[model samples]
Target chain A: MENASVPSVDNIRFDGSARTRWRLGFDRVIGWLLPLLFLVAILPILSLVYYVSARALPTLSWTVLTSTSPYRTDALGVPIIGTFEVMLLATLLAVLFGLFGGIATAEFLSDRVAGWVRMSANLLVGTPSIIIGYFGYFTFVLYFGWGLSYIAGVFTLSFFMTPYVFRTADLAFTSVPRHIREAALGSGAKPSQYILKVGTPIAFPQILTGVFLAMAIGVGETAPIVLTTQPGVLVPQTVYSPVTFLTQLIWENFAQSQSSGLQVLAFQAAFLIMVVVIALNIVVRLISSRYRKRLEGLYA
Target chain B: MRWLRWVAALPALAPAAILIGILVALVGATSFTNFGWGFFGFHWDPPTDQWGIMVFLIGSFLTAVPALVFSMLIGIGIAVASATYLPGYLTRILDPFVDLLAGIPSVVYGIWAFVIVAPVFGSVLEPWLVMHVAFIPGFGPPTRTDGLGVLISIFILTLMALPITTLLIRDALRSVPRDLWESGLALGATRWEVVRRVAIPYGRRGIFSAAFLGFGRAFGETVAVAMVLGAATNLPKNVYDTGNTVAAQMFELLDSAIGGTGSPQILAALAEMALVLLGISLVVNVLGRRLIASLYTEQVQGL
Candidate 1:
């Protein structure tokens, strides 16, 4: 070390030494920079909320929500029903498999096996939604000859969600306290019983967060549905039949050529989607808080 | 009991199987076409049996790289603020906003980007840039058209990629030991200086990982980029020129691929594109995950 003067700490005083001044300058720049960049990052979502609401609010009506047989951008009735039915089905499928898979990783699998499963799930989570959509087109729509039907779309969309559910559920399950696991295992409880009664309840809140996350993804995703299912008016009579979706409604209506009135319907559909997502977020918070409070209030 | 354990592990097989199945499907399709290395050439005309993916690759590069740089900057700001600096109220608002943004599907972003954002860039921003900053390379006058091009796609992708990037980076920066910040500050460093020297350095790998993950995200984004990237195969002349990404190309031509409305060649080509895309994202995400193995749900299993 050069002993002439310790440059960073040398002459440390109120006005800041040269190095300190430089650091302060950088600090000031960053102080301004971080907040400014944050605002820029958020600008889209802010504008999206404000602008879509402004356009969609006045145009929203019972007819838009309830009417089925109409021209382009007329109503969301069929899409609404289809979305609800399909999302419920998709969420069920996603959660069920995600739970089993999560349980395997958290409770049953060897370390190497669990590592592979976790890695695969993480990879799929980042795998492009479009690729998943593309896969859905090939595997479900063509290979299976499902041909743009309800079950195909449900399976496709559900695939997009399972990785998320798995990651979160695995996390929740693994975090259960050691004593609790021992207590459950020491008793005469079967493996399944121990996992179901003790492990799941302990981790349910965190797992619920993933459920809501998948729910939100289910509402927002369009690629899987569009590629794997047909965009038609009526709700599918059977899993084989074609069905419509709200995101499709929003997608088709946003064309520059659509009349302002028609465009309003697109905004309405978007706004409706925002409402559902926001509600899921809020509901998850509420439930998690209540669940935590109950746990702490009773046990802690 | 042994059978029960094996049965319990069965569900873990699904994700790995699906991933391999996708690879197999894409490989089978690529083999069917027999395009081999010829698939990576420049042109994409289907009529004369000229099938190449170079243009869409370039398109994805143009949009996704810039989007990565931009979102990284914004994501760092967000991560730092939420993780360390911002007061409670601001983060309170920010946390929910980001959560809502994550849930706002790509289709909505597609609509908003095309209808709302593209016009502003076209009618207002591009003209001003043309007047004032024409000398700058990326800010030149429009060649093919205005708005709904590489610039708008980049902007939309930045927004689309923000939530996860920010969240990952926030997790990284937040994981910086409180003791480190306190030690820095106790040594007479300001709060900002502590952030500069302590929190950031500690969180560097996580931030880089976030970039890789975010890059994969924006690179593979389809609906928004397709809706706004002008849907034309024109090699983008400038930031304002329309171009097509591989994902967008797949979206546009996928119908013909299956229905036999166009040609069997297109399906094989799209499958190849999907495989290439999968290869790229898997590498990116694996690198990302490997960089911060401890940053995941940090749980200690019961003995």
Candidate 2:
């Protein structure tokens, strides 16, 4: 049998060994404590979802979700519609602004201009939604006298969400290989044609990912809406008219003292928003994973 | 070629112009009427048309600092453990959980804090602390509803910031080259030593940037703070005393301003918002620039 060549303990130097042992002990202690720490970190989140769902689920139904709040009762329909209307409008605005901004930053601009665009995008991303809400409240609602209209809310959310889309689109465009762009140009494509036909199509999935992310963020957003969009049950007769969405309906219902049917109905709106956010997150995951799988499949 | 480049650049200019406009408006508003030195002076009577932002400033700092510290400690520890010690399956499990936490709205977290965490802290941690170690001067007189104070706000804010901090630090740790680890291992160093001596040093700037991002998130957070924090517009005597942050106070006051109280109060609130927007923008920009520069430098050095 061959003898193993393991180093002898005596031959090993113990310089800084004590410090190492202390560190090892500290790490071991931390390792043991980590699961408990993670549990503590998770407790509030788990309990939140559990408690909100428990309070909201039994009350939530297709009727509550589909129908407006009961009349004079501070009920549901107007608010749900309001939420969707605002989100849809905001999403559209975000896509348009994002596409232009992303294209400009990635393809059209000099490096200095691109750098400035990137910085602004970062600042916008970092800026709180409430601040945007306040800006909307000040500029549109008060200064310009828009008066709590859908235009105010849509503009506010769009401004805030556009940065996200811009980041996504820019990344998407950048991810397209230089070789492809060159090849497109070599094939007699104009710059505009190259961007519109080649660049955008190649980056469509990523651009969609960005838009979806913005939408997901915009849909769940309560702060910006809290300031600009009128809260409570106000059903718009038309897109130009002011209307409360599901979130507003819920907030108003919860804010009131009297336990009217509409007030009771808010629990359902809250649940629906939560469900929508979770579902959107799932969709985001699915899209991303699918994109990754496609890439992997091609390579393999 | 230059004209084409300019054409391309035009699109990028739009966002920059928008951001610059916002900054200009904010600064212009703040600087209107001789730069509004009255904003800095101590005269906070709303009814009498006296305005001071001292309380809100104190409130913001008080809430944000503790939250930043607590979250950084816990987040760094978790990131380190996940990066170095955690098994693959556990890491994957934790990733989704982090994402879930990140995805949940701040308002929902506020509701959760109000409903669940408050009672637990009031019933459990407060009593235990009082019994065992609350004899200290700052720790006197534990109250029941004190759970909804600055401390609880900090706790909730910490949760909000944790996912970002964790993700950033984890990425930072992952960016540390394998050669460093291999060298350490060859030298017969333990994993803990290598992490403490090598990995953390390399990841320090990244970790700092992560913490700064957390600070920004905690500082600017309004809805959650508004919902759960008792919203008493006072300088908190103790960590357990009810208080309001700058953002929360702005939210509470914005509606009133809209309702047409007076010109001074509305202007004062506007000035406050402008100040906060400027402060946060400056800090975030500086930190972000530093982070990007550091990253670029690292990449260059690596190449």
Global CA lDDT computed for model 2: 0.69
Query: Residue by residue across B154-271, what tens digits does model 2's lDDT show?
Result: 8888888887676677667777777786577567665666778998898787788877877888888887787667777567776677888778877767655655663754664565
User: What is residue B49's positional error in candidate 1, in angstroms?
Assistant: 1.3
Chain A superposition TM-score, candidate 2: 0.85
Best by DockQ: 1
Residue B217, candidate 1: C-alpha displacement in angstroms: 0.5
Report backbone clashes per prediction. 0, 17
**Candidate 1: tens digits of C-alpha lDDT, residues A129-179:** 888887888888878888889898899888888887888888887777777
Supply the TM-score for candidate 1.
Answer: 0.92
Instruction: Give DockQ: model 2.
Output: 0.32
lDDT of 2 at A290: 81
True interface contacts reproduced by each model, as a fraction?
A: 0.59, 0.30
**Clashing residue pairs in candidate 1 (N, C-alpha, C atoms within 3 angstroms):** none
State how far residue A39 of model 1 sits from its true place (Å).
Answer: 1.5
Which tens-of-lDDT digit does each residue in B72-182 have in candidate 1? 887777777666555566776666666556668888888787778878888888788888988988778764334778888988888877777787777777677767876
Would you estimate the TM-scores of all the predictions? 0.92, 0.89
